[model samples]
Target: MVVHSKFQSDTVLSYSGSIPYTCYEIGHTWEPGCVKTFFQTFCDAFKFSIRVYTVFYLATFVIKLRKKENRRIKKIKKLLRDILQSSIFLSANGAFFMGGFCMLRNLIGKFYGWHGLLAGFITGILSIQLERKSRRGMLALYLMNLAAETLFNMAVARNLIKPIPYGEVIIFSIASAGFMSLFRQRNGLPENLHSPLTLIVGPEESRDFYRNGGNFSQRWRLISCLPYLQKLLQRLKTVHRSHQSCPHNNSCTYYTLEGIFKQFLLGYGIQILLNALQSLRGKQKWSKVFNNISLASFLAGFIGLFRACNCSLRWLLDRDIPALHGALSGAVAGTTLYFYRSTSIALYFFFKLMEVLYFRGIREGYVPHLPSADQYLYASTLAIILHASCCEPHNIRPGYWKFLCGVSGWKFPVMFRKLFDVFGTKATTLYPNFVPDLDPRYVKTTAVMELLKVHGKWRDPTNF
Candidate 1:
């Protein structure tokens, strides 16, 4: 669907009172000069975003820092610049959001929920240009994941839809199944993109095996650790002859186990580091740290089961129905979600499936291609987040709310929100601890001192 940004929408309701900067919270300091605000917002966002972007991009260096075209010093400089570009992308997006809200209030004569949408959408188009083109689709995809979940929760809250048990698992299973099916059909994985399944199932399953070798797609790269175990694996040759259609080398058991061990160690290492970081905050749960093997086992089980099921079913049936076997095995493997459940992981794969399907549709002439979908998705997602942050803080994911707080330089608490009650979102009621002076309707009301109250003991801001 073509999502055209406009002031008029079906969502419009009460137009009472002014929606100007002073009347409502725009989630920023209401200073003059959009240009100045943009730069100010940029610096604040950069301080936080650089640390985040650096951590995120850190793995790239660890994985392939040696293959860069630039020299050691130059590579570091270029990487810093690249990271800066992303920080700017995030900072500029927030600045533009504030600017857009202000502009919309003035031009439209009032503010509405859709105003956020319009502003977000416009800024998305403009700001996306500053981001690396390669990352645009990925950014859009991530936001789409968040948007999809937020909308689902909203629907459930409104009683528009019933919640399903293990819904995320179901979604992940289907998506993974679709992915495996496509991979087997030799037309699913994106060109030149590294797929995680390559390590699990091996490169023989890949269509561009020659081109993709050593490009983070090979199964052999990670399993070269543990010299003693390596010696043992080297001695054991293929125990079972390969089925004619088998896209793997050596015995099936060895191939399957190698992936399991590698992935297990990888997951364990990651979880340990995370646990250590959490420990640094003086909240060390020493009681459960050693026993926290769920992540490791889950990763191992994921690939172990997938390889075992696929190979066993293939050999037993004596024929490889690529789609059927691939899908069935994928579903079976996804059942390991019981080992470690994560809505975030499942949702990520679900959108990945959507991307695969959408692209496939375009190729097969079954779907209309939209060139600007990524930009729109990113913008709209941000719009939803900004709107909810002020008008319905209770509805947003707490972590995301904190993220907005960081990026906006702690502006939400200072934002004027009492006029926000005009929209009937119950902003004051839900987030009752906002600054006392924030409510334009009434001044000098005592703000809650606790700051982080949920249910039992929150000071209500509505009491005049």
Candidate 2:
């Protein structure tokens, strides 16, 4: 009777198991439920975050080591501090932008993958408030972010790895890299424009010293005997001074225009040379190359004209609303790049103007002062989060990316340097004959340095 009961129970159990069980064991089951999926995703995200942070920390450490030779303790402390700051900034930016992008994608329906472009544009604009960097520098950083993201996307498309949250990766990379770059010391002077005079004498003194200098020769020698070039420069200077004395001489229309013309000519010549090389490489017709050269030259000239006009307008309205002046100048510059639909240029300048005003307010104590570190952390976190959570990515056409890529090759750097000069950063000395790697410190003769010392002493009688 007991054996008969056991057989019956086993038969009943087998009968139940033959059908799929509601919550547990069944004939077959494969789906991971919501909770399990969520946990898995969370684990993946955490791993990704750690890997990214490690890479960033290592890169930053290497850069800092190369830049400074501090003692071991101090170096380690600095590295730790920077890492902490970078991690915080990146985490905040990533969390915020990711939410924002997801929301935008839902609302705008993807926009043909142009959402990335919009995110990048916003990133560039917002970066200005956090770091005192040139617009070109900010743009370059953003492009780097985009390129990295694109490469990752390509890898995913090729099934190199399982699908992962790339948006998070991009935002983190950009924030970390941008923050890291804030600490990088600018070369301050371009290699092409390096000169003994520039190294010894400051920018203002060098400009004054070279005011009567002649045009650059074929060999880039600063020859003073070029009668026609000297006459033309004198006339331009005269016209520039005809207007009210600009508060900032660097912004003077005449000087700005002259600088623009010089830079344009140099850039145009270089473009022609590069085109020749390209033609040889591709075995293209000379006529086609010549046509391209003409087009490039025309574009270069247009950009130079627009920049000169912007500088002039800023100088003319120096006394009035400075912010408005900046906006107008930016608008004018943007108009010139209208062919490329570069409205971002205007937006960039507007933000730059606002940033300047904010700084001024802080200095004058009109604005409440916050601790620098706290301010950076808080602002960066807030801006990125806000952007990510609330905003949708505005799609930019793919053609625009191609156009930008074409323009960004070699000429972009030269163009950016000219813009830097316009802002009076003196990033490149105007000296035509300077060679790279000629350090002033190694020279045995202290004649020039001694003269400068005496001149400085003369200017400041208190020192005597």
Candidate 3:
């Protein structure tokens, strides 16, 4: 059976001491108000970083990095691209955050004994499909995820191992969607205009295909879309017998860059407004805002059902999977949230160290193989710091854990132990069983020493 003792709490409340330190009178002297100060400082620093990165991204274009040859056109193009890209990024991020929020909400309900969790799960699945730009791919991903989820849930229900917590499920779903994004990167389209589109079939064609279900029916239905099919050719000949040039066919290769720009502008204008409003409540500083916008845009430009799936998967399972010692694990988890940011700022400095060391190599002029090498490293490093801070032992308390489970919105028991085990291998390495040869005092402060000391010791019964 599963059990939770100290974690149980009524009405979620914030507490800050030595973080998770339980110093009941006869314990070590602890910092009184450091936790609250740390959180506030972190947020303020993060906001500043976001502002700097945003300014640089906009500045780089304005300085004409892309179009140095022509001053006038450079300004126009730079402004145009920035506006268009920013708009797309904001909208996609809004969708991403919202989708993730809903996915987590559903998972929480399902894991806990809430009646509405299953209902929410069904709605989330359908809503995600409807929200996707590609119905076919979305349907495919939905079915695939549903299968995985059903099997995983069955295993949990039967007590084959441990019950996966709602937190882990939320993380897994988001990670899966992120992984799908990586695979969905388009190799065919140009960098600028590769937005995804939905595929639709006519009504009459749908009916005819249902009536005759053989190979012939399939071939004929597909041929209907082609203008050069034998049936269409005969019909065309009957309609126009004249072998003369038509007025509509007169030669003209007029190109309107302005029209293309307008099309881009109009579509993005509506989109940006929606996104900005969605994210208005969580406004950070300029650099952090910029980082959020750029990262969001990069993900947006590669929009598709597959990418969404990638993001979801990464959120769900990335934490569990072992990679490049502890380096890859931290980088993957952190970078998923941060890339394309600036240093000097606190969050940037913190997260970037991870990116530069673990993920990116500065050989020759570029960090090869990795996607968006520079941005990824910069952004990921920042994210690692933020995540570390958020999940740190000191920042955590019984109330936050309850709130994280959505127990108030829907009181439900989640198997966090099993959930942690899903990513146990990676987490184990991070909170290693044995201390290294070096002195503990000399190790990097960012090693999450406090968290490691607790979970690490817990992993070994003999050590206790």
Candidate 1 lDDT over 1-464, as tens digits, reads 11112221224335342343332333443444456656676677778888888997776866766666544887788788889899888777777777777677667765665666677777777788899988999988887777677677666765789978888778878877877777776656775443666655566555545433344324454554767756767654356676776666566777687778788888888888878877777678855455577788888887888888878887899877777887888888887776788777888888888888888799999999998788777877776766666666666666776887777655565664544655656566555555333333322222212221322334456664
Candidate structures ordered by lDDT, highest first? 1, 2, 3
TM-score for candidate 1, residues paired by index: 0.78
Q: Which whole-number lDDT from 0 to 100 does residue 193 have in model 3?
A: 18
How high is each candidate's TM-score? 0.78, 0.33, 0.21
Per-candidate Cα lDDT values, in order, are: 0.67, 0.36, 0.30
lDDT of 2 by residue, 95-182 (tens): 3333333344445642222343354334434433433233334433343334433444434544676654333433333322222122
Model 3: per-residue Cα lDDT over 252-341, one tens digit each: 110111122223344355546555665676643333332234434322322222222222333455422212112232223333323222
The positional error of residue 67 in candidate 2, measured at the CA in angstroms, is: 4.8
Query: Which order, best to worst by TM-score?
Result: 1, 2, 3
Model 2 regions lying over 4 Å from their true place: 1-39, 46-244, 247-254, 261-330, 337-464
Q: Write down the lDDT that model 3 would get.
A: 0.30
Worst 10 residues of 2 by lDDT: 20-29
List candidate 1 segments past 4 Å from native: 1-40, 72-74, 191-195, 204-244, 248-255, 422-424, 428-430, 436-464
- The window of 10 residues in a row where model 3 has the poorest summed lDDT is 246-255
